[model samples]
Target: MEGRNKCAACFRQFNKMEHLVEHMRISYHSVHEPMCGICRKHCRSFESLREHLIGPLPKVDCERIFKDRGCDLCLTIFSSRNALWAHRSTCQFSRPNNAILYRMASLGIQDELRIDSSRGKAVALACKMVGGGSDGSLDLCARVCLVDEYERIIFHAYVKPTLPVTNYRYESTGIRPEFLRDAMPLKQVSRKIQDYLCNGEPIWQIRSRSGRARILVGHGLDHDLKCLELEYPPMLIRDTAKYPPLMKTSKLSNSLKYLTKAYLGYDTQTGIQDPYEDCVGTMRLYTRMRSLAHRTQDYPLATDPQNRNNYASWRQTELERMSPENLLELSRSDYYCWCLDSN
Candidate 1:
């Protein structure tokens, strides 16, 4: 017989014993471990944590409240339907237009742009804000730190704001006018960041060669990438904010501060925001998650072999015959997870 390694709780097979051990250590499967209040199943991460409560296979009991009280922006499940109605206005923002070229034009900054192709590795990044806008609008990135998987700083810079500083958000951001006086212009920062993310390959060519683009790991990446005026394929991004298992019961995102404290057992952003600290914390979280020995078969199939009918097109009897576990196994993740590639 061929040697086999499998997780007892989830029935996920692993190719090696060490991977099974690692998964057991992190999974902590027990009656006392954190579990989906609805599913009565232990979850490996908050992404899965929320998934059990709100996603495709959510419990019927939780589904009703979730639908009436879920906040799409923050992913919080409110106490009552009225509470959700009240919070929606505060949670969402009007989507910003492509801000890349406008930022360059407003700053009138120019610099030589170059790419360094050889340096290829995953990176964790964090952005510090300058202000929250004059009338409490959108915040701006004033500083950024990019730390490699090995915890070395590859790039760190104070970025000049393209928009006039409004509220400064000093208590949290710790930014001042002096910091921006000689800081790198937004245009220059954007170019350098682009080069780093793409290595030496043309951005347009990265899609053809999947490995050419360096992976970006961060929390609240949508806001940071927006402020930087940067675009990366969703496949290359490992965002803690949007990962389903790490989210809230209502399918909204959890705050980085809360996630760090709950999962990593530490406090962060207690005072002024330091991008380097955030970078390291974010990196640690990514490493911990990527180490999980998820079921390989659960990874999205590379190609469809069966002439299978769509779920909606299937007959009721066919659906009823399959167990809930089997149905969930057939579902696909909207984005990629490194666990899918792990051996």
Candidate 2:
């Protein structure tokens, strides 16, 4: 079978070993991998999983229910259509924002919060939490660490949980009640962090332009931002967990602990987690990625006239006419890389 260039998992035959390797990478058919909850078939990627649910030959029952309650982003099927609707607003590929903003909009504080730009240098921050959620419901923020590009700790604080504590998960959190007893309020912590992120500028202006708000480098930033009830534009966030090349073989995310050990030659979060250590590790990873040479001095911009037409509309022969480098340029990245902006 090996000499015959056969894929054992899918039983597909290939002419060359290189083609088989590419097939294995694309098929990602492993026994231990995640399987579709409906058909129980394993997928190599989320795109393939989506195809299984909605493609031309999709599973009949799964497709029917998915139309009513499926989440396009996570491929999760909610219990009800209403639940699916509620999840849709926040189920975008980017992180979710709470409804807290609607109340602020009604109060007209949205404009009040917008001010001139502050022009701050790029910095990184990381947060740690204990007792994730009440009664196994949600995670709460416990500690935060903000460091500048030079690795200087600009702000560090222990946060008091607004909700009653439930499962401390002490083995990993290493947080004690006494540590948070005298900590800062959640609102106060949020405001201070917002001010730091805003860098004396209004959030609106920072959102509109670059070089004002600092670039945030962290792992699982979506979780951290959600716990703190904070929001930053997705473009400004550099999440190592979500980066494409760093992902697992199945195109799923790899844990920060595994990434740190694999890339940095060390270990972390063995017992209790440390926000500062996480922050430093994330910043190091960010810097390393930013330093990669994509080898193009002038990369194509999204708005370029040549890029105006969607690649899908191009004729097969037209695409075939393109050079490999040109095809690579036309292709989209699996995930957004901040280094692309720098280039």
Candidate 3:
């Protein structure tokens, strides 16, 4: 009979116990790795995980159960048939109404939103920058947009840059000289956005996640905030560009345009880029990631006291001797799983 020492992630078996120990040392298996919702086996990416679950020559047991329980969009498995049906509504989102954009534009959402972050909902932000400085080489904030989960514009405005505009980048932004003549000044606009985002939470309380501070979602938020001259709490921000699981296999950030097309199955930024549209796209991506269903972890994170020192050199010898099943049983996620956000 084959030895019981099998790697849980790759399912590789080794005759010698020492060989399995070396393999475990090299393999960086964790909950972050896309995993089979049924068998709990870790795979490299969602693409490979999809192949494992539903592709030709799939595992008989997993394929059978997944057929009924799995979500086609996120590849999550619900507890029951009823659960799967309930999840479909969330998994499948409706397209945002373009008419709302024109209506909101006329009203000028204008950063007057009252945030109640006690709701723990995330909002998406996007900005458009025009060129400043000699030869139009510097970026100056020209427009900004913020949207809620329902794709409702909470804030949208053309920002008058602090510096003189040299290039309007009209081919992309469609901003004309007249648009900024009466636009919100950058100082006033940034302050209003900052206040709205802070939502009455003090700086200290924001990081503790104990206050009503909103969780800001966006792509390249650092750049957006810099352009706007605003700062937000790190913990209260979710930038899709930096989220590890969303990155390319090469460990580089994927463009929002590419991510939208690949995951949301649509095209964006084909012509004049609308900040509202960017806001909607980023919002959809954020919510989609937050909606994933993973096994509720007990020692939820790898940093927990129970698993924190598991990798210490002193414990290495002991870990190597444990059965493969035992080692995997102790494995935990290195990062906080976004599924917890669903609660």
lDDT string, candidate 3, 183-270, tens digits: 8999988877777777766666666673566778999999999999888888678888888677765558889887787667667887
Tell me how far the alpha carbon of residue 122 in candidate 3 is from the true structure, in angstroms, after superposition. 1.1
Those runs of model 2 whose alpha carbons end farther than 4 Å from true positions after fitting are 1-120, 132-137, 297-305, 310-334, 341-343
Query: In candidate 2, how many Å is residue 296 off?
Result: 2.3
Q: Tens digits of per-residue lDDT for model 1 on 1-343?
A: 2344324422442233334333433333432123444445665455565555677776778666667776543345777888887876654332212245224423433334334444336788889886655585667888877877866566777788898887677788666676677788877887788777888667888767757678899999988999999877777888888875677766698888877765665677766667777787777667766765555543343233331233433343565465544444454433355665334
lDDT of 3 at 187: 92
Give the Å error, residue 186, model 3.
1.4
TM-scores of the candidates in the order shown: 0.61, 0.59, 0.76
Lowest-lDDT window of 10 residues in candidate 1? 93-102
- Once model 2 is optimally superposed onto the true structure by TM-score, how far is the C-alpha of residue 271 displaced, in angstroms? 1.7
**Which stretches of model 1 miss by more than 4 angstroms?**
1-120, 132-138, 298-335, 341-343
Ranking by TM-score: 3, 1, 2
Local distance difference test values of all predictions, in order: 0.64, 0.63, 0.76
Of the candidates numbered 2 and 3, which has the greater lDDT value? Answer: 3
| Span of 10 residues, lowest total lDDT, candidate 2 | 105-114
Determine the C-alpha RMSD for candidate 1 after optimal superposition of all C-alphas.
15.4
What are the clash counts of all predictions, listed in order?
9, 3, 0
Error of 2 at 264 (Å): 1.3
Candidate 2, 27: how far from true, in Å?
Answer: 15
Measured by TM-score, the strongest candidate is 3
